[model samples]
Target: MTTYTPPQRTATLADAPAIAALMRASVLELFPRFYDERQTASAAKHIAAIDLLLIEDGTYFVHEADGEIVACGGWSKRNKTHAGDGDAADDDRPLDPATEPARVRAMFVRGDWTRRGLGRAILESCRLAAKAAGFTSLTLTATMPGVPLYRSFGFTEVERVMMTTPDGVDIPGAIMVKDIDRPDSIGP
Candidate 1:
């Protein structure tokens, strides 16, 4: 058997399709355990939204290994439309990679990589990229399972967001924020 080694690299646009597929798989697997039936479809839609968001901002990234995208994440400058909008912190509608404080847009890792630190690595990679791009802070709406992960990175809960899927079903989410200037720092 081949030993598993974490892949190292960022995904380019060429990796979008596979990365999106991987994202879908990850979400589909979580549907039953993480959400009601109403929330299941939204998981895939969120994957597409992330795909568009990254495409619009040119921030799609992933770590591939053995010809597959095992980990994926995205980053952007921040949103202009929602700059002052409440509860609309992350999406700027048109999406931008030059917003004042950078934001971690999307992150997903394949199941096989669990417990191998890929999630932390992806978060760090996106954080460092956004910081290098001049963002001082990062924020995201974390799913239940992701809460602890974000917390470990110094992300604090800002609010519990009751979000509705496109189908009018509500899902719980945590609006979280992290200070990039913290001593722990960011990067893979």
Candidate 2:
């Protein structure tokens, strides 16, 4: 049997609603295994947000299957590491790729689409894109469910963190980093 892979493409502003829906579904279904009800709800509301700046920068991407977005993720050249932090003046500041690590932000895959290599494919794209933009490393803040995926993709845990949402719920997560310029790093 032939397995079909969805086509990936750069995300546009028009794709925002669909991507947001997908992120919520992914978090709602997968987060329960690692997070309690309150934490999950807080994450669904805050962490699943779309940063329009990524689309504007042409850095975000989505995987389309049957005319729907099944997966979405991207790398960012800006300072924001992840979404839902509320607005900050430095969030849009450009990172100097020569000295700073490019950020891998806002990765989400449909619940049913998990374990099918979509996350790896997205990470590979992020790594290549960041490298092409002159970044030597990449970093991401990974929610519990995403830790294994980032680990398998050559990212090492830098620190564990409790992400506090505006609602004051604490979500357990980790800061992960990968040296993209390393010869041993894996790719898709």
Candidate 3:
């Protein structure tokens, strides 16, 4: 048996279509466990929206296994914590590192790749990058299905929130935060 190689590099505009597809698949496969059909559809549509800013900023990444994107996620130093395509406005302004925590944004793993350490790897990458950018803490708005993974990364739930889709449906989510004092690891 051979070991699988993890994704190593920043995302680019060329990878947008594949990454969007991965996000949609992930949401459809994973959200059903915690959401109803209508909500799932709304969430899936939202997840499918890819923000090119993250790629342009070199903060987004895609994991390729056999030349296909198996996972995608990223961290952001901007004010927008989370939003999909049409949901977000033109807010790409940088946040004050002196006062604001780095935002962990757009984390998604293909359904076939779940529980395989990909998500954790992407998260560790985010943490290290954020810390290097002078952020002492990090924050993320995690969907209900994503809460467990964030929790395992030592992120504490600050509050329960609802992510509204453009259709006015509210998807349950948690606003979780974590500091960067400890060593970050996804485990071996």
lDDT of 2 by residue, 1-188 (tens): 56677988999999999999999999999999999999999999999988989999999989999999999999999999886657668988999999999999999999889888788888888888999999999999999999989988889999999888888898989999999875335543
How far is each candidate from the true structure, as Cα RMSD in Å?
Answer: 4.8, 1.6, 1.9
Clash pairs, model 3 backbone = none
What overall lDDT goes with each candidate model?
Answer: 0.64, 0.90, 0.84
Return the TM-score for candidate 1, rounded to 2 decimals: 0.78
How do all models score by TM-score?
A: 0.78, 0.95, 0.92
C-alpha lDDT (0 to 100) for residue 109 of candidate 1? 70
Error of 1 at 32 (Å): 2.6
lDDT of 1: 0.64
Measured by lDDT, the strongest candidate is: 2
Q: Which pairs clash in model 1?
A: 11-62, 77-97, 77-99
Name model 3 segments beyond 4 Å from true: 1-5, 86-90, 185-188
Using TM-score as the measure, what is the rank order of every candidate, best first?
2, 3, 1
- Name the weakest run of 10 consecutive residues (lDDT summed) in model 1: 80-89
Model 3 local distance difference test score = 0.84
**What's the lDDT for residue 45 in model 3?**
87
- Of candidates 3 and 1, the better by lDDT: 3
lDDT of 3 by residue, 19-53 (tens): 88888988999999999999999988875578888
